[model samples]
Target: MAKQFPHITDTHRDFIARQYVFFTASAAEGARVNLSPKPTNAFRVIGDNAVAYLDRTGSSNETAAHLLADGRLTIMFCAFEGAPLILRLYGQGRVLHRDTGEYKALLTDAFGEEPLGARQIVLLDVDLVQTSCGFGVPLFDYHGERHNLDRWAEAKGEEGLAAYRLEKNARSMDGLPTGLFSEEPAEADPA
Candidate 1:
């Protein structure tokens, strides 16, 4: 059976904090839905009705594009090592780029500092909270987070990352504009 709540209670927040991973789901009206597994450290519960996460650079910017087209977003956290439970936050999400002052302030307040490799901040204004018995969810032992992403970002440096984003992240697989880069397209690189 599933349970619903109007806001994220203290207990719910505590459960989210204990988890090591979560998943984000989003979609546009006529586009393919995206469900992405996210590390727990990247997420934060901002308030009873709000949450935010640091979105690092990835192969695609589907979430950003979908959010731009349709603000619908759902964040799910499951208990893989504890009691059998799954929590979902259904909300509207906005993608905040690092260039914005709000993004800078929020990043600092949430993480003590701006994390390297952070491409955008996904802020959610949660309206509905749901929990279900995740009896079928298998338990897995916790190991540790991979350092490969950080290492790759460090090697890319700032200028390299900017160019890469402009090239690869400006559009989604569905041809929806992600607005990740500038409105004007950059010059194409020679193959």
Candidate 2:
């Protein structure tokens, strides 16, 4: 059986906190649906009806682009071990670029100093919370988070990261603009 709620409850919040990974799905009108598995330990429940996650630099920026074109986003959490339950947060999402005040406040309050390679913060205004029995989800043993992303980002440094984002993340695979670089200072024209 499935149960639905208007906002996240204490039980739901607790379940979210125990999860190791979450999946996000988004799409624009004419673009292919985008689904991603995020392993970063940066998801936060800001309020009963709001949640946010730190989005790291990836090969593509589909979520931000899709959210820009179409705000609907769904985040799913399923139990890999423990009581069988699957939770889905259905909502509208917005990308808060690195320069935004809201992004800064949330980062400072919940996440402390931002991690390297973090591209933006994705905030979702959750409208519906649904939970169902996850009896089919298989159990898996836990291992520590891989530090490869951190190492790669550190090796790339700030300038390298900027160039890489400009090269790969400026647009989605569907050719929709992601606005990832919208807040960056314009380069001085080399006269």
Candidate 3:
């Protein structure tokens, strides 16, 4: 059986806090839907109807692009090591660039520190919260968070990261604008 709530409840927050990972899904008009798994350490429940996550640099910026084109977003968390439950948050989301004061303030206030490869803050205004029996989900033992991304970011440094973002993160796989940078992406490098 499944239940739906108008907003996030205390129980929902607690369940979210216990989750190790979550997934985000989004799509622009006439574009393919995008889904990505994310670490929960960067997630924060800001209010009864709002949450935000610190987004790190990735190969593509589909979520941001999709959000810009269409605000629909869904975040999902399934119990992989506990009671059988799957929670989904349906919402409108927006991106705050790293240089924005809102992003800086939220990073300091909610996350304590900026993570390596940190690119943007995605704030979601959740409208629907739903939970379903996750009987099909298998339990798995937790190991630890990976540090490879951090290491890669450190090796790239700030300048390299900027260039990389301009090259890789400025557009989605389908070439939609991600709003990562104000300027248009330079011509694709020819190899």
Q: Tell me the whole-model lDDT of each prediction, alpha carbons only.
A: 0.92, 0.93, 0.94
lDDT of 3 by residue, 11-119 (tens): 9999999999999999988899999999999899999999999999888899999999999999999999979999999999999998889989989989887877899
TM-score of 1: 0.94
| lDDT by residue (tens digit), candidate 1, 1-191 | 99999999999999998999999999998899999999999999999999999999878899999999999999999999979999999999999998999998998889667666789999999999999999999999999998998999899888888878887788888988897877746779988
Q: Name model 2 segments beyond 4 Å from true.
A: 183-191
Per-residue lDDT tens digits for candidate 2, residues 1-191, read 99999999999999999999999999999999999999738899999999999999889999999999999999999999999999999999999999889889989987899999999999999999999999999999778898898999999999999999999999899988898876445779999
User: In model 2, what is the error at residue 65, expressed in angstroms?
Assistant: 0.3
Q: List runs of model 3 lying over 4 Å from the truth.
A: 184-191
Model 1 whole-model lDDT (C-alpha atoms): 0.92
List candidate 1 stretches off by more than 4 Å. Answer: 184-191
